[model samples]
Target: MVLAELGFDAGQILAGLKPWVECESPTYDAAAVDRMMDLATYDLVAAGATIERIPGRMGFGGSVRATFPHKSAGEPGILISGHLDTVHPVGTLDVLPWRIDGNKCFGPGVMDMKAGNYLAIEAVRKLALAGHETPLPVTVLFTPDEEVGTPSTRELIEMEARKNKYVLVPEPASADGGAVTGRYAIARFHLKAKGKPSHASWALEDGRSAIAAMARKILQIEALTTPDCTFSVGVVKGGQWVNCVSSLCEAEVLSMAKRQADLDDGVERMLALSEEAGGVVFEVTQSVTRPVWEPSSETLAMYDLARDVAKEIGFDLTHGSAGGGSDGNFTGAMGIPTLDSIGVRGHGLHTLDEHIYIDSLVERAQLMAGMLMRLA
Candidate 1:
C-alpha cells in the first residue's frame, strides 16, 4: 500500500500527454507511428526504464519495449500493453484542443488512449522513485497498429505474452469508470461483389447488378445475428454513375460473437449467401482482431488483486466487459491472466471530441502503480 503513498507529478504527466495528442499516428501512417514510437521510448527512458524498439516483420511500424528488470532472474515478467495509434487523421490535435472544462480534458486521443500510455510510464516512475522492488520484472509494450488491427505487432505481442505471468492492458477505462474484465470477440470481414455492367435505362435486364446481389446478401447476413451475437455491414463502397448499372459492390461486415461456434456459423451463412448469388463473384476477407475475454479463474484472481489495491487507496473499483478489443484479447486467448481498461476514464473514442478526465490522470496512475506493487 505504500506504493499508493508515492505522489506523482500530475502536471508533468499531463504536459507530456498533451503534446503526444498532437502526433497523428493513424493506422495506415507508418511514419507517424514510428515517430510516436520514438516518443514513447524517450518518455520511458526518462522514467528510468531500459528501452528498446523491436523491429516489425515487414519494415512496418515497430513496437517499443521498456523494461524495469529485477535484480533476480527467472521471475515472471509482467507485460503492460497499450497502443500508440489513434483513428484520427493528421492535424486533428490542433483542431481538438487539450482544454480542461471543469473535471474533463478534451482533445484527440486524450482518453483512447494517449493518457493511458502516459499513466503506465508514470506508474513505473513512481514505483522506482519510491524504491519499490517488484516481485517480477516489469515490461511495457506499446504497439503501433492496434487501432486498425494488430497485424504488424500480433506475433511480437503473443511472443512476449507467453513469457509473462500476467498481462495488464491500459486501454482507457469504461465510461462508468469501471475496469474491463471481459471483451467480446470480433470477426471482421470484407465482402466484394463483381458483376457485368450495362446501361441503366436500356438493356437493364441483360445486366447482372452486383449492388442488387449485395443487398440480398446483406439482408441474409443481418438475419443471422442474435442478441448474444451481432453483425453489421459497417462500410459499403461501389457503383460508378447514376446512368450505368453498378458492376461492383463491396461491404465490410463486423461480427461480435460470444463463442467461436457463433462466429463460425455467421461466417458460414455469409459465404453461403455469396455462393447463392450465382451471377456475382464474391470474395470475403476475414480478420479475427480480438478473441473474446471470458471470465475464468485466473482472470477473476487478477480482478481480485486489482480490487484489493483499489480499496487500499480509497478508490472503489468494479469489473465488466466491453464490445471493443485490445491487446488484452491476444493474451487472454493464450490463457494468460489478463486485466484491461486500467487507464483513465473518458468518452468519444475514435471521434473528434475524445477526452480524458483530468483527475483520472493521477488517480489511475496511482491505481496502476498500486497494482504493479501488489503483483510484484
Candidate 2:
C-alpha cells in the first residue's frame, strides 16, 4: 500500500530531488555544500523533523542531523545515514545535465545518493500525511564529505551511530541488485620521491631520476595486489623542466582488503618500501584509512528482515560485500548493525553518467517506509 502511495506521487519526490542534484555540492566547496544543506533542512522541516545544523568548521560542509520523534520509544532509534557531497566538481551540471529518458533519470548525484537521501524525507512525509506514527525515533544524518573519504564527518558519524540501534545507509544498490553487508577496508597513500638534479646535456651522470624511482616503486606496489588485497595508482606528477633531471615526483596509491589482518600486512609492506631507483629515494604518507565492515549476527538478522520486506513487495532480495567504503563502514566496523546499498538502482557512479531509475524514486521510498515501520 505504501509502495502504491509513493508511486502515485512520484512527481513530488522529483520536485524535491531536482534542486539537490543541481546544487553540485562537491566536498571541497563549502559554500555550495552549505546551500545544499539549507535545501535539505527545508525538506526535513516540512516532514516535521527537528533540525540541527552542525557547522562545517572543518572547512568542508555543514552536516544535518534531523530527528523525528516516535510515538512509542523503546530503543535508541534508527540512524539513517548518508553524505550530501558528490565526486563531481562545480560546473559538472553543464556537461552532465539532468534529464529523463524512459525509466532512466540522468543527473550528477542522483543514484550515488542525492535521490536516496530524499527517499527518506519522502517516506516520512508520506507517513505524516497518512497520520502514521513511527514505532521508534529516527535520526537522519547527512554529512558533507563521503566522496572524499568522510574526512570531516568520520567522528560525527561514529558518535551518531552509537545512539541508534541500526544504521541504514542508502548509497547505491549493489550491481547485482543486492544490499551491501560487508565493505572492504580502504587506505590511501601519497608517495613522493626526491633526487639530485642536473642538466640533461652536460651533467647526466651526476643527476638522479625521481621519475624513474616513482616508476620502479609503482611496479613494486602493483606486485602487492592479490585476490585478497588490491592496490591502485591513481595520480602521477613529476619533472619541473624538460632539460633537467626531475628533483621531485609524487603518486597516490589506493589499497583495499576484506580483512584487517590483510590490510595491516599490506599497508605495512607498502610503507616499508623505500627502495632506490637511479639513486632516488621514495617516501610514503598514509592519508586516509577506513576499516573493513564485517557483518555481525545482528546485521545478518537485519538482512534477513530486509529480505522479508522485499519479498512482501514481490521482489527478490540479495546481498553482497562491497569494494568501496561508506559511512556504514565506520559504524559496522565498530560491530554496530548497518545496512548499506538500500538505495535506487542505477549505474555510472562517480562519472558523468550517474543516474537513478525513474521508477525506483517511488519504490525505494516505499520500501524504506516499510522498513522503518517493520523494524521498529
Candidate 3:
C-alpha cells in the first residue's frame, strides 16, 4: 500500500506529541481540556480537514470533529474516535515533566492517549502530504470527557459513529501488546448517607453516625465482588468534627462486569442498599455508564484486517476484550464494526510514571495508515 511506504518521521512525531503531553488536560477541568482541543483543531485543519467544534455540555470541555477530504466525502466511511482528556490534573506537569530516557518517553497522558491521537493524525497528514487520498473518507472525533466515563459526550459519539461504516479508537494498546476488540460493561454510582448528629461523648446514644453507616455499607458493597462482577468504593468523604457524630457522608462506587446481565444484577443489588439501615438513610444513584460490547463477527473481521496490516508492518497483532471502558464501548455496542486500542504501546496508565515506547510511534502510525488505506 502507498501508506505503508510513507515512512513517518519519529523525531517529528515526538515533536508533535510533546506539547500535547505538556498541556495536562484533566477531565474535570473544562478550560484545560479546551486548550488541548484547540491544539488538535489547529493540527487537523492544517492537515486539510474540515473542522467542527461542538461546545462542551455538562461542565466538560468541547469536542473536535475533523473530516478529511475524499471523493466519497459524506458517505459511510471511517470514524476515528479518541479522547483528549487525561486523568492527570492541570498542574501535573510540575511533577511528571516530559522527558525521554533511552527508548521510553515519559510524561503525563503520553501513553494513555496523547501519543495515540497524534499518531493517527500524523498518519492522515502523511497520506495527504504524499498526495494520496484514503480509499474511504475519514472523520476524527476527539472528546474531552472520556476518563469520567464519557458522560458529557456519549450522545455525540454515538451520533457521529452511526454515520460511519467503521469506528477506530486509539486508546492505549492493551497490556499484552494487542488491540481491543471488545470491552466489558462498566457502571459508576454515587452513595450518600444522612444521619442525625450529636456530641460523641455526652450523647452517644442519641447520635446516628453517617460515617458508621457508610463503613458498614462499604463492607457490604465490597463483599458483593465475585469473579463475574467486581465492585469498589474508590472515593469517600465524611465527618465534620472529631468529637461529634457525623451527619452526612458520600462515596463513589465503580463496578465492572464481563456481561450485561451480571452488571444488571450488581446494579440491582446496589440499589437495594438505598433503604434506611440502622436509623441512617442511604441513597444510591447511578452515574455515568457504559454498556457491554461483546465482539461480533463484523468486529472480528475488522480485527482480521488489522492483524493482516500488522503482519505487513513486521509484527504479529492480537486482539481481545478489555475490562476498562472506553468510547469504543459505545461504538462497538452499536454494532459498528469497531476496532479499538490501536495506539502507542506503553505502561503505567493513570499514574505518574506513564510513558510510551518511542519506537512504537512510527510502527503504530504505519499500522493505522495501512488500515485507513485498506478499509473500504
* Global lDDT scores for all candidate models: 0.81, 0.86, 0.93
Order of models, best TM-score first: 3, 2, 1
Q: Indicate whether candidate 1 or candidate 3 has the larger TM-score.
A: 3
Model 3 clashing residue pairs (backbone): none
**How does each model score on TM-score?**
0.92, 0.93, 0.97
The global Cα lDDT (0 to 1) of model 1 is: 0.81
* Error in Å for residue 342 of model 1: 0.6
**lDDT for model 2:** 0.86
lDDT of 1 by residue, 1-376 (tens): 4654788766878788877877778867778888888888898998888878887555457789888757854457788999988888778867777787887888877788889888898888878878887778898999888876687788889998988989999989887888887887888788888988999898888788889888887887788789877889988988988878889999998888777677677777666655535577877778655777787788889899998888876778899878877888788878988999999988888887788778777788888887787774
Off by over 4 Å in 1: 57-60, 199-206, 240-244, 276-278
Query: Regarding lDDT, does 1 or 3 come out ahead?
Result: 3
Off by more than 4 A, model 2? 1-3, 6-8, 72-75, 198-206, 240-244, 275-279
List the lowest-lDDT window of 10 residues for candidate 3. 1-10
- Ranking according to lDDT, highest score first: 3, 2, 1
The number of clashing residue pairs in each candidate reads: 1, 0, 0
lDDT of 3 by residue, 1-376 (tens): 5445797988999998888989889999999999999999999998888999999999999999999989999999999999999999878889899999999999999988999999999999998888878889999999999999998899999999999999999988988779999999999999999999999999988999999999999999999999999999999999979899999999999999999999999999998889886789999999988999999999999999999889888898899999999999999999999999999999998999999998888889998898998899
